[model samples]
Target: MEIVTRADRPDLRETAAAVFKERWPEFVFHDEVPRRYTDRAEKYFGLFDIMVLDHGSVVAGGWGVPVPWNGAVGDLPSGYDAALVRAVEAREADIPATTLSFMAAAVGESHDKRGLATVVLQELTRRARDQGLAHVIAPLRPTWKHRYPTVPMDEYAGWTRPDGLSIDPWIRTHQRMGARVLGTAPRSMVIEGTVAEWESWTEMVFPVTGEYVIPGALNLVRIDVEQDHGVYVEENLWVQHR
Candidate 1:
């Protein structure tokens, strides 16, 4: 398997997109903030988007953007949405970014458990180091958090195994790679849609207005049938790599 940047291998863009769509939940594609900047980020910072391919078939991918950071955990962007915004704004204003904030990483379903995620992350970090960035951070979406949607992210992020590693597989992977948890972003990514849209995304019925747990959701989705709206606010843990 070989890893390459999207900029250098634009031919793999379609393969990478298929990997992401297959791994991520359908609702994840509806976030307005990311939808607005994703194209721009790719157009400007394509070097930061990396893909792993096995015999020229995409197996894994990761993407991030450079942002100006103060080197303080408390000053980090509120979450993924804010970080993307900061990156775009900084580029437009001619401000040099000091950090690389990872946005998303995914391994194709057929290639799970092959350590491709670690490979993708390592490549991202290597790229950041080569660029002279001071820090590499990720607003991580815990792999197991969706199973415990009612739990607060701050509390969930604190859960550890007997070996002192994170309980969530995704966070544990980062921890094993020398990344330390910084904090929780309670409102990392927000998804809002009409009641009908929510039902279609989850393939579950939302007959009345109330909080309902849906598959692949890390938090409760509030549905207000009377208002014809449903909203989901996701939380993510912030981790900084050494």
Candidate 2:
């Protein structure tokens, strides 16, 4: 199995777009990927850093990015921005390590039950550590995954696991991989029924979630999974690498 990270290449953009296509709904509010990378790319993938693609079929492939994203200003337990903020305020760089948000990971529906998703994620972790980033974070929510079911997806609602893998097995899984769950957080969760359903849910909860103003926010605006071709889910998860 030959795996690769892709960007800027003529042929690879399509593959990159494909990965973004499925992954964005959960994060970016926009329903479609722009024809070209925009300023938003600067926030996550400044250079060739936006996304990663793993080679599967020559023309078609598997992909992921060693992406670093910002967390909500209120997400910090102390109601601060990135961990760096508290570190700066307390004058303790060692206390709060900055976290890069994990926006999305999509293993093609056809490709599920295999270890490719893990491969992409492991590679991402390796890349992040090499870059000297402190940790990886994800605004992840299991039930509210913003992927389109019509398109291909791993489809394991609520904290995805490799096929036939049980949650109890994660103790071993975590050991084998250099990854482990940071801890569990409870937020107003969402479910995938209709865009209207999620929108209504967001309307109910986000106002009270706290006013977080990052430089830019991936719009959590809802679009139907298939009909609207908008984002997939609005759930969140925060992750880290070892």
Candidate 3:
């Protein structure tokens, strides 16, 4: 498969959206808040920030945004929400972007084990380097974290395999690609909605006020039945590439 940007083919918006929907179900509930900024980013940067395919089906995609950075260690935004907020601010203020922040990367189900994720990262970094950006950072939502939603992010991030690599395959991929884990973004992305909304999204019943492991949630969702609200705060790892 070949990677193509929106600049190359402006009519692939629906194709890109379909890929996102397939890979990220949670986005259905929480993307509205950040969609405005991401849409603006696409407008300003063209499809340069979006990675799709041409001539063949898109088996992988990467999404990112350019943001102003101070070139200091530990200065990246905490997570996806904060990172996107900064990106929006920079764009609105006409501040030149100094770094590229990768928000999401995914390989189609049938394309797994083909190393498409590595290819996506290489393309993103090459794009950033071509644009004269200093580095690329990611708020990585580990692929396997959803399996153990009750584990604290700090503990999960610290997990290591027998070979001394990350237990999470996704994090291990970043590490192998030369990214260093800075820390955990405890409140990377927050989704809050009514009980009815959560029920519809997860297709599960929340009868009382407490944290429940809803389907597809990266972390337990806190449901306040009396208040008719549910909140999900996802955790992610802050990885930096130099």
Top lDDT: which candidate number? 1
Off by over 4 Å in 1: none
lDDT of 2 by residue, 124-239 (tens): 56666676667654433342233322221123223345753323332334335655444432221222334444445344322232222221122243444446222332223343
lDDT for 21 (candidate 1)? 91
lDDT of 2 at 8: 45
- Model 1, 1-242: lDDT tens digits are 98888888988888889988986789989999988887888888988899998998999999999999998988999899999999998998999999999999999999999999999899999989999999999999999999999999999998999999988999999988999999998788999999999999999999989999999999999999999999999999999999
TM-scores, one per candidate: 0.97, 0.46, 0.92
lDDT of residue 208 for candidate 1: 89
TM-score of candidate 3 on Cα atoms, chains taken together: 0.92
- Candidate lDDT (C-alpha), each: 0.92, 0.38, 0.80
Best model per TM-score: 1
- Provide the RMSD of all predictions against the true structure, rounded to 1 decimal: 1.0, 10.8, 1.8
By the TM-score metric, which is better: model 1 or model 2? 1
After aligning candidate 3 to the native by TM-score, how far in Å is the CA of 29 from where it should be?
4.0
Cα displacement (angstroms), candidate 3, residue 163, comes to 1.5
